[model samples]
Target: MIQHIRISRQLIFVNKILFVFSLFGLIGAPHTHNIRAKRYFFPLFIAIDGSFTEVKVNEWKGAASNNRNQEEDGSAFIVEILKNLGADLVDSVEYGDDELTQILLSEIKDVWRRIVNNPKSLVNSGETPESLGIYMAKILFIAKDRHCESPDETFINGKCFPISTRERSEHCPENMGLYDDEKNEGFCECLELTKEKAKSELRPIYSNETGVCYRQNTQGPCENGEWFVLKNTYPRCEPVPDGCPTDGRHVFWNPDNSTAKQCWEIWTRGPCDKGQLLHLEQDSTEEPQVYCSYRLAESFFTYSALSFPPCPPGTLSNYVGQCIGCSRGCYGAFIG
Candidate 1:
């Protein structure tokens, strides 16, 4: 009878413990939905040739560039790249209010594992996890942040906008606009260099949605309205106006070397425009004359792509092929 009473007491204690655990489960357990939401992977659009293609996050893990610290650094860099391409990254993800967890390497890997288990989380299911972590991070970032208005339109702030149109023959300048091809909707954006300009500092110039800056010849005005032509048509405008386009496969040269000094010498003679990017091609990999050509035209460089090394540490090869130094308080950076 005494043993029976002890067993009953023990049972009661176990029941109490179980009751406490059940209560904790009800009140303190992590939300499965929140975990799923955190695991949700987003699609990233990559412009291939002239069209944009959807890339999954797992696939991007293989392609992302590793930092000096052996961590995925390309994610943050790609974010800046997207901003330069003209979309509000923070606002697009709805994370302006919440601190973004995916930006960190731990979360990046964690989300990747979840995505591997459920391929349906990606827009493209067949993609394999390659060395595309940076690319994947960027894709996931945009996917998580992009705010869609309807099935057809994307929302920015309170307004709805269209998706990006077809890729143009030329890369758009900072003074120009770009559309969001990620949504496959129409969302053209232009740089507002004059956004903060005071009324006194501004001029009444005719601006249009195209964002093309036209230069009038002004040679006594023909039947046409002042014989204006695209600034790009001139030989002087041959160099990329908005800096070099970032393809995933760019190799940057060290500007501090002797080879770079030779390139600087060429830059000094030509008086290249500030921020112009020149591409030099070579047949033999070793000690070949690095012919300088404009980044815009994809065609193989002929005589025009001259043999020059590279600009010095403090300078950038500009549009006119001149070595332009960085302003005071600023450091020269090579974006390869």
Candidate 2:
């Protein structure tokens, strides 16, 4: 009978421990859900008092307040938040109070979407919703405290600028001037003397490594059998490919045609006028023909060999010489 009583006490103690664990689980579950719900409804919980309040999923009333003063104050607060997030809503004056509130809400929703999509950005799991909103605002908008990974890069105007750490005098070699804008931005560029020389004679490509401008198609610093060529605006010594002219006139074969076995002069006006380069034309029926065409800016140098004209204002040229129309509802000029 005594052993039976002891067993009953032991059972009661085990039951009590189980009940305590169940109670703790019930308390912890709500807290976990509350944190998740706050993140999930971050856009809806944007309060005017700079505090985050729990918002029900079904309780999103449209921004339609009877009090004009209260609505304007709320709109102003939202505008301030957006401006702090790097949003330049310069045309806000064009929108009415109701329209502007809707736009601001849309912008807030966009920010919330970004935060929700980026899981790795949630560094602090225990951060309050208000603090998280502020943290995410900095991340999505201004990025003022963003860390630059590159050793040669510096943060400027909420963006990364590839500025050198060398002295101003040593930034560029002789004959190259440092083009510094009113801002603290600068880059090594060829001076007027160098530019005139390049235009009169063969164009010289600037070398970032040696800080010297070397004439194209020449053995400036290259080893024997290799010539200095501008490979995508970068000065590099590359061997002359087979079947290409060794006289430094022809650099690459026509990218449009592999079977044509024809090579073209890249920068220099070979078999063309001073302002033109030799261009290739290949139609489905007609035989391949070559003609003199005006050279475009360095940005279009890769497309120099093609015979197609530049795309129209609202279109862009693809690699295969086809003009693709811009997507519907797109604004601004689309240039190559």
Best by lDDT: 2
What lDDT score goes with residue 111 in model 2?
42
User: What's the TM-score of every candidate structure?
Assistant: 0.21, 0.29
Q: Model 1: how far is 291 from its true place, Å?
A: 20
lDDT of candidate 1 at residue 24, scale 0 to 100: 23
lDDT of 2 by residue, 233-334 (tens): 245788866656545344454434534445566445764567876654322112223455665432221223223333322233443233333332212210
Estimate the TM-score for candidate 1: 0.21
Q: Residue 187 of candidate 2: its Cα lDDT?
A: 41
Residue range 246-291, candidate 1, lDDT tens digits? 2211222334354443212222212235554443332111221222
The runs of at least 3 residues in candidate 2 whose Cα sits more than 4 Å from the true structure, single-residue gaps closed, are 1-81, 84-216, 229-269, 272-276, 279-292, 295-336
Indicate the residue-level lDDT of 165 in model 2.
Answer: 18
